[model samples]
Target chain A: MSTDRLRDVLRNSTEHVDMVELTDAALKQSRQITVRRATVGATLAVVLLAGGVFGAANFWPKTPGDGVNVADSGSPSASAPVEPGPSTAEGGGEVTVPPRIDGAFLYVTENNGLISWKPGSSPKTLIADHKGGEDMIFETANVSPDGRSVAYNTTSGKLRLRDLATGKARDLMDVYEGNFCGTPAWTPDGRILITPNTEGKSGLFNPVTNKYTELSFTVNGCQPRVVKQGGVLMVYFIDGSVSHLRGIELESGKVVVDVPNTAGSRRATDMSAAMVTADGKVRFTMRTTTLNGTLGDGLRGFGGDSLFELRDGKLVDLDFDDRTMGAAYQGGDGLMVLRQKIDGKYEVSIWDMHQGGGFDTEDEPASLKDALPLGYTY
Target chain B: MPDIAAEFTEFARTHTPSLLRAAFLITGDQHLAEDLVQTALARTHRAWRRIEEGNAPAYTRKIMYHQQISWWRRRKVNEQLSETIADTPSRGDSAEDVALQLTVRKALLQLSKTQRAVVILRFFEDRDVAETAEILGCAQGTVKTHTFRALGHLRKALPELADAMKGNV
Candidate 1:
């Protein structure tokens, strides 16, 4: 319509608004917000100050390359994904796999309970048999952002941190039975975000000092992402039949934006992986999960996941077709989506969010298929 | 001074209708419009003392527009336009007006969320370019660009209403 007619129609439409109902709801929610603020204040009182003493210190000693583990394994095939098998090296019959490609680097869980990877030269064994456990014992072994540490969960329900340089694995905390801390997402500054219970008592656990800061709000969903640029902790939860994607501000612990998936809309019903793009926006995948499905595989869900970009507080469909089980990583200047074919082959799709060029897919290692970023946990 | 609770309630009730009109235009859905207004009001209540004396309506409008632009949330279904408006048609309204309203709503959804916000603030709310830019937290140049693009989109989407508009915008 003409600009004037558009204005007239909208102004006249307000006659239909129920002011009393709207005001009441707003007032009630405002009261709840006040309560939440109070809760955050109370929780802050008990935050362990011991971790702050370290003050963002590197977990490993600084070496050349600014402590970044660029030690590349001498495996002839550099692009091959690591597979489970017996070690080929002739030293006391150790079983090991090629280092998994994490962005431009790599990491691997040794059968001897060591989380270590050397990037450029022959692999460096941090310690000789520091602990005894099969490779399968360590679930969700994720390399840290600085490539100096690995955060993993044991099958015995312990959240453990392994220093790749020292080969020391320390227990950070004990998780509840039947749940593994395998879904830990690392912040940009390298603190592990773990929801150790079903009640959504999530918080950031610093591996350097093993201190935890409980979040003010509970997150019922797994795979919570802390987008530093957006300053919001993005989460996905289901409220009845409607799935909700919310951004909780990290500093204030306030939910700044909430998008709900309503029936008949193309919005995400269930979200999968989320990663901050080069332009500082979070991109995630959404799929519908059936009751019969398992939470393993990071809730890959039925019919695969479709890509969506969070823009201007709305979920803009990225028009990506799916079966995308895992995708996230800041590998290059573009955003990456790792998709797996039904035949078990994996490929990477890179899309430039600001630029409108469609994504380019190239065959990639299955190791790049992770729910979190390349160096983050499953 | 009046009771803070009562004062806030009165403020909410007084401003909600006008807020919903702008919200409805931006969201293009009756339910989402209510949600946008309510959320903004709730935030305004938190800062009530600070803003109550210093233009609470503008503060709340800024929150509504900013939240709509920068926040991330899951999608909720859009309720049918006919269902909400049928019961409360203003006097002298005809079927043609209703049809036009629905058509305009549909056409508005075609634009990006930011584009729609620019159109609503500039046209529906009669906000000047600077005011619209301040509310949306964007540069004035962005508002002008979006306004130009949005008007072109609307004209194309609603050709029957395309008769030359007398409005300067």
Candidate 2:
């Protein structure tokens, strides 16, 4: 009877629940999840093959009159197989730094400090004892559109810009107190879109002139992605119980495209970072959690990330194989995906959204076996 | 043979009431309880084919607990103290029963999320320490510790319910 009393109390607590409404909401969310899974499975065969032709060609040493060298300084040939770097134990291994991929230098945080790594060379420490002493620099640090500077926020709330050439760092603004979103996004025109301030004021900040232009409209989102042709800024933000992707026209400041997540399904689709194509196609990385014992034993903790592209206002999977691709950058004519191969190698392949073709393999000067893609030379 | 959707709908309709009751006790908020149940069912629907022949309700409850633990922590501001327990003449409950239920509900919410889950599993669901630990993906020792601490808090908060809670402690 005592046990019944407790059970009755618990049952009475839910007496007000509307069963029909709850069932309908659950069904709708289930359909969305099904759609997401099917979309991902369909795009599996649409693989970016090995050629590295379009944007990756720029990483190789160009013959005279080729005029293609951007971040090129390594001796690795385009076709020759360079030996893999000496391996280390899983967590304590040596960092395999990559050669300049597509003229872009990667800035990563190791145990020592923040290091700027180029192809065929060792990682040079840019800042010793940096404020944010974690590998999370890869999440917040973005290479400028020109690849001349890297902008990263410190744990102390200081947004600092480190020049790749001079290695000098300076404070842009103190945004630590505000609800500063992660990863300060760079506009195509080379200005950084600072996450909105506490007052909901966002602006385009020109790092060179140290000038800040208030955006025509106030937008709220984290991980803002912009296309090169720049009509709208794709912003990802969670409002209350749902996550949304709203395309705000840069000029009018009006929301042009609004993709709201289903109610009561926040964890089902966690859009951490997104990439916007010139034609307005958006691909985002969704982080899903594993259902501990129920799902599987191997997938106990974080249920790794899945790449999804927003098509016709629905999220389709963008992953082709087991290899996980990082944030894509606008290359010459298409988007360049930096894919980590299953055999412990890195491939910088150009994916033409319209055309399907084979990718050419080019050997990176040093293996970026443990590096996170921050930004690239565009 | 019903398709996945049709089968899932029947499953959702049948199990949603118990899921809602458990979720309401776990979250102590009607809106969050509803959301928790929906989210759990959504995930259950994803692995429906895999778990359809297996224990679907257990899988759903596991998802509900895990999701609620991760979610309510982030949305701490929205966690409302549950309303007073509704009086039911059909249950033959008196005024003291209502007060005791209200006290138990409020006291349950006061414990940490993990402790609250442990208490609910051990007492309400009648799960042993091993089962509670397995459901929570924690060690049996953790469940025992949480169980001891939770019952201590409950007995301290509701002295009237102390005799009923004796065996568990």
Candidate 3:
């Protein structure tokens, strides 16, 4: 029909509509939405206020005579027997005591030492500078799953654990004589440390019994990330140009799940990191490209480097882009600890995979201050 | 002090019928149309102070158009369209007009979302090409192409409507 006739038909068709009733209904809905938004805003404000108060109460120093000791290890010569009450400093200033680092914390390697950081507190250097020589590196340290102990390959090729509470370091094993290459992956129960040994083999070192057992499987040039369930390990290896994720049953050295050519491209897949979930599913971040061109070059070109999870026995894209640099499975909650590049700085964030599967950064991303360039674990 | 709620309510009271008609044309479902209008109005109410008094209808229309497209893109399964047309009169309406309306509605649904939006804006809303392009966030040439293709689809779907247009011209 003609444009004018079409307009007339559309306009006339609405003649029988009850405009007043629709308006009332719409107004009510609008008001309801407004009320809901206001309520959410108020609730958020109250929650933030409560959180601030709670954080201050928990982290703030107690007043003088509050029966708290402020110990300074560096000032050992001034080790006076601390009374039950808080004492004033020699300079007459109220002594401020550092709060104990509790809950899950991060152990980051600095130049040659390790720094421990909790969410609300400042980072504390647990290990002093012991820079690596030509054949030994002291920075490849792994924090236990419980965040209690830190195990590192020393410059002298000794595997040592530093008790965070006692600030003492003790040798666990000597997996290598020089140049320890592989990182220590801690099991879920914190009982075993899976260390990569010489000659493309892996060894399980128990700190309690000082017993070391070598595995039969060879994971040459690959990092073994352990899953929480069933002693399964997600071993990432690159053979020639193709990358593979092999799920190995730790006890029997049996390969259960094998995914060859992770990106399903003939091109080389350069896998950055992989983490296994509690349910034994593997999630990895990698970049794949053909010989000459970028990622979007081949037939069935998946976009640039993104996160993918092995779901239902196939690699499924998680829609995350290259901004995510590293991810660690946050215990059993289906939430992952993600290190993302935001505004040119690598910031730590928590991504919820269970609820709609995206990074929920409404809160400010945690800063990776005083952290080593590469090593971080959750 | 002017009551924002009262001002918004009065605006809705005067404009709900036309807005509902536009939403129905966009979504082709009565319940969905009501939902679109409500969502648009709620957004408009939230931004009532920032929007100029004379531009409330345009602002609400923009929200409804964009929201409809977003919902269409996000939903995996297409919802079944209701067979009963609420706007079509039952007793007094001529059967020919009802049939023609039904055919036009069906033809409109067959067009892609952008094409359907172009058709409704160009013909029913009487928007110029440039205005429709700006509203649809597309180039003027793209709007013209969509309008041409939509008209071609409608003419093919309803040859009788093409003849009626020719006779009217």
lDDT of 1 at B76: 30
Instruction: Give candidate 2 regions above 4 Å deviation.
Output: A1-101, A105-107, A110-139, A178-180, A198-200, A216-218, A228-241, A261-280, A288-304, A319-321, A331-334, A344-368, B1-169
Chain A TM-scores of each predicted structure, in the order given, are 0.52, 0.56, 0.57
Which candidate order results from sorting by DockQ in descending order? 3, 1, 2
List pairs with backbone clashes in candidate 3.
none
DockQ-better candidate, 1 vs 3? 3
Docking level for model 2: incorrect
Q: Which candidate ranks first by DockQ, i.e. highest?
A: 3
TM-score of chain A of 3: 0.57
What is candidate 3's TM-score for chain B alone? Answer: 0.86
Candidate 2 residue pairs in clash (backbone atoms < 3 Å): A49-A359, A50-A359, A50-A360, A51-A359, A51-A360, A52-A359, A52-A360, A71-A103, A99-A119, A100-A119
Q: Provide backbone clash counts, one per model.
A: 17, 10, 0
Q: Candidate 3 regions off by >4 Å? A: A1-110, A128-139, A178-180, A198-200, A229-242, A264-280, A287-305, A311-314, A330-334, A343-347, A356-378, B1-169
RMSD in Å for candidate 1, one decimal? 21.1
DockQ list for all candidates:
0.17, 0.14, 0.17
lDDT of 3 by residue, B1-169 (tens): 8798789888987878788887777777666778778877876776688677598888778667655554222131134444535344534557786676777776777776778788788777878998877666567998888877887888898787664333211
lDDT of 1 by residue, B57-157 (tens): 88789778755542221123123434544444444568787767767766776676678788888877889999888776667998888887877887898
Q: Looking at model 3 chain A, report the run of 10 residues with the lowest lDDT sum.
A: A67-76
lDDT of 3 by residue, A110-192 (tens): 45555655444566666555554522223356555444567766556676777755666677766565534565655544456
Show model 1 residue runs off by greater than 4 Å. Answer: A1-3, A40-378, B1-3, B71-74, B77-92, B164-167
Q: Assess the local accuracy of residue B38 in candidate 3 as a C-alpha lDDT between 0 and 100.
A: 82
Candidate 2, residues B1-169, lDDT tens digits: the string is 5498888888888998878877877876666778889988986786677664757887788767765554223234133563323332224457676566667777887876778888888877778888877777667998898888888898799876676677664
